[model samples]
Target: MSAATTAAGAATADEELRWLADGRRIEAIEAISVSAMARRLPALVVRAFRLGWRIDRGAVGLLLTCQAVSAVLGAAGLFATTGTISALFGPGRVEDKLAHAAPSILVIAAAAGARSLLGITIRTVTIHLSPRISRAAEAEVLRATVAAELTAYDHAGYNDELEAADRGAEVCVDIVGEAQNLLASLASLLGAAGVLTVLHPALLPLLVIAALPQGIASVHAARVQFLANRATIGDRRIMANLRWYIHVKRNADQVRSDTMGEFLLAKYDQVGRRLDASSRRAAMQSARVSVIGAAASGLGGAVVWAAMLWLVSTGRMSLPRGGAAVFALTAVGTSLRGIVGYGADLFRTGMYLDDWSSFLDTAGGHRLERGTETPGAPRRIAVENLGYAYPASDRKVLDGVNLHVERGEILALVGENGSGKTTLAKLLAGLYLPDAGTVRWDGRDTRDLDPHALWRQVAVAPQDYARWPLTCRENITLGQPTAEGDAAVLRAADASGAADVVARLRRGLSTLLAVEWMGGEELSGGQWQRLAIARAFHREAGLLVLDEPTAALDPRAEHRIFQNLRAVARERAVVLVTHRLTNVAVADRIVVLEDGKVLQEGTFAELVAEEGGRFRELWDLQNERTGVPARRTRQDQRTVPDQRTRKDQRTLPVREDEGSGR
Candidate 1:
């Protein structure tokens, strides 16, 4: 990369890193504590269950029922074990004892079988429900993104929030399994604790004491990993972006020709190494905590076993009850360990889900809030004292600008790069609202109109139009076909010079535009630009905006587009923004902009007649480069009316009168 390019990339990377680190959830993770996790755990579990219930209530209901039944069966099996032990000890003959124990053995087998069946049912329901929960979460994210104002994308923080929410959506499915395990573990612990209480109240407390250390260790390990993940979020994002640049097909040629593959790979490795270091530190810390906890837990278990022996020796618990205590203690201990492990996983997942939920709640803090007024096709669209500055900047892109366009007129915007030509065009189309003055359709301000309803009357062929990976027909119509259907699409294709390109496609208008797909085809740059223009032409709107519309077209195609421009403008107002001054000859009037202010405005002939004007200077520069004559003859210029007489005939300023088709 050039030095300037490298500097720009570094600046962007720094901004992104700052944004990622400033995330609300990242800040929360930095200060994470066991007490905070405990407080948040209930709300997170409730949210997960609510989400599952909303997506598929039947599956959620089935899952809960199965868990409850399985817990009951587990408790019954423990009770049956106690009965069998008691019967065997109460025997006269060995044969008599075995016979008496048979009924209890039968009950134990039945309970075990039922519990196994219930476990299978729980797993099946969880599998059925998890994906739907994920899909619902993802869909909500998409909806919130779409509802946000166009200006929302200008903020780095908003983009960072979107990335985090996407990760949260992806992990949403894992929460379902975590929740099921947590609930099952809790239920099992309760059942085992109850059985042990019936055997002896003293033994229930022993079970908790034995499991406490391991439970604490599990939770601490989970906290360590979660914090590590949060710390590396920015680095992971950087790595993902680098991988895309190195792996995408569009960059494949540049990678080889510029010898950038190794450099890119090295950058990727650098980011990956940072992430790996964080992971290693987390793993070692977790291991240390686990080892210490295990040693403490071993000591606790010895104490519990010794207490049980003393109870049995003192006849506080009989031999039959002692055997049952062994089974109950094992069950309760395992369940407690499971409860801790699953709870920790669920808490971590819940933190990520909070990102998703928070974004949906605020809609990236830029959700659209426009008026309810629906506008029809406007006869005249007006701007007065318009000004705007993009997010995160004080520099105004368009300041104190005034302009208008009416139906049946074509107004051209001409300027050097960064002169706000495209920004002005966007403002006129209601894609953005001005920071200072009003843009109005007829007499109503744009802010007073329903945004979607207003946009329905506008069509745009932007400088960087999307190359939709869809069928040619869908690309042209943008998935909104007219009643005329194919006839309308064909007419638009012919007008934009894309009919020839479509005819050469393997499946004509049905051909897919992405080459990566099976049986799909790709288009050259010029061909894609033609399709983009056709998309705007296909829409039956009251206003049409084309920015650098012919930038990629050949001379003949460019000529054809300008030749048809006046006819297209006969039905709707047209705003044309381009650097190709020759094409502006077809415009009814031209406006020159410099540094966010209008420098000149007139008919093409009038602008050309002004000797030292910006337009004439640009025209002369282009003429010299193309080896054409620098100026028209005096008599040729006289053929056009003088600007003095034209101004005398207008009652309003040139900006409004010219747009009024005077």
Candidate 2:
């Protein structure tokens, strides 16, 4: 097959892989090999240290110093205890032995007290540092997520990756703690080993032998758990979304209306059971490994005891020195096991941290196109043979399509659902860079101009406009907050029919818009649409793209919006994508799209005059449904009366019955 075909196939496979990740089944992530993990451990440690250090350098340094000094104190305490034991058991008078042992006992006490103080200091520093590190990491993740291109949200893989990364960020503070503990444990283990070597050089080798089995087992167990977690991340993300849909206030009504409580509850139970079963299996495997490790450790301890007895019997070692060696050997073994356990924990935490790092790379790779040149408002915007496909999809949504819009012209794009009209509009608005064409603003390629600068000249009202849960004023002035209460804000609100909507509010423009909030009110669908249009209008850009702007409006409100289109277009270009054919009748130009291609383009009258055309067929169909005559003269195009009065606007009033809210 050709290279394009191969790429398309790869994309299809990737999409299929994502499709399988719906929390219904376990799909294991490819496991990292032991060798690979070993190689990556050093890098992960360095990264973790840097992550912690960046948030609070002083605290990290202090924490490290405390751990190092505490380890040294630990070794000193072991040595002091050994000396005290030897002195007490030596052949001498009671008073002499007591005098000899007293100094060593004091040293032991001082070392122990110092270690305890250092431990307290470490805890204090860590407590202050964790939240700061967590916040910083969280901020980085949020920044990367928000700055990513809009197209990334369309793919399940991207969202799953982001969710995984978000989860990792949440636990990053804990990972830092784990790293610190791991280092501290390593120091303790080394201190014990040093004391063991001092007591008897032969005993140090026995400590290593005793720890080998448990170390292997701990690492193996960690790997098993890590694999389980990695495999379940996508499922966990799906579960989170489902839980949100069931419990969040916004989705409550839909859940009740559709009787989805039982269905969603069943889904929850099903996923939960699968996860529980997976957890049980992983836990069983780890337990088995631990048992085997315990057995090996007991056998190693027995061997060391046997060797010590043989040395004592042969008189090769003194009884007092041998007893100290045995004690040091036991301490070394315990500490070594703790170090291994901490190492396992660090490996697990490091893997999760890797998710955060991987997500940053993944999201950052698909950055918004950036350029150095700033662009001015365009007199003409043109698309040349545009072709585009969504991420991880084989089929192109727009293909070989060309179009143009200029100042003072209203271009109406009318097409059926899934006909690429919205996609074309996004390309025109510079929200997306075309895969196989150029969008030019005033004869200059938009790719060469800064995207932020280019977007300033364009304003868009998307079909599914966000209903921000803020004050009405804030929502309307979102794009032009600095122009709030200015003549322009009011003018845009008036032009979009939002001024009348705002007039009916209890608190007027300052009223919050979320029904779930105290003293807040919800707007009717049409009113919200009007507010979205107001937001777009507030931008006062040179190019305006309205996608189904009046879909929820009543006949009169819809008519009022189209009636003002000529005035709105007089100062800037307008691209209107709508299914309402009646609204298209007044456009200066009409473009017809079918199956990702431009089927026809002309004046509305010219298109209607043709006997056979997609535009005419759609117009005829709409006329039949509405029972309205087409080709109406200018005198016949009068605005309809306001069919929807005050009651139609779902505004809150200060009356007792209305709960004194808006």
Q: Which candidate is the best by TM-score?
A: 1
Candidate 1, residue 202: lDDT: 84
The RMSD (Cα, Å) of candidate 2 is 10.4
Give the least accurate 10-residue stretch of model 1, judged by summed lDDT.
650-659
In the range 75-138, model 2's lDDT, one tens digit per residue, is: 8888887898799889999999999999989988999899889988988888788888778878
TM-score for all predictions? 0.89, 0.85
- Model 1 Cα lDDT, one tens digit per residue, 568-661: 7889999999999999988888999999999999999999999999999998998876575678764455456666778655332324344344
Each model's lDDT comes to 0.87, 0.80
Tell me how candidate 2 scores on lDDT.
Answer: 0.80
Mark the 10 consecutive residues where model 2 has the least summed lDDT: 16-25
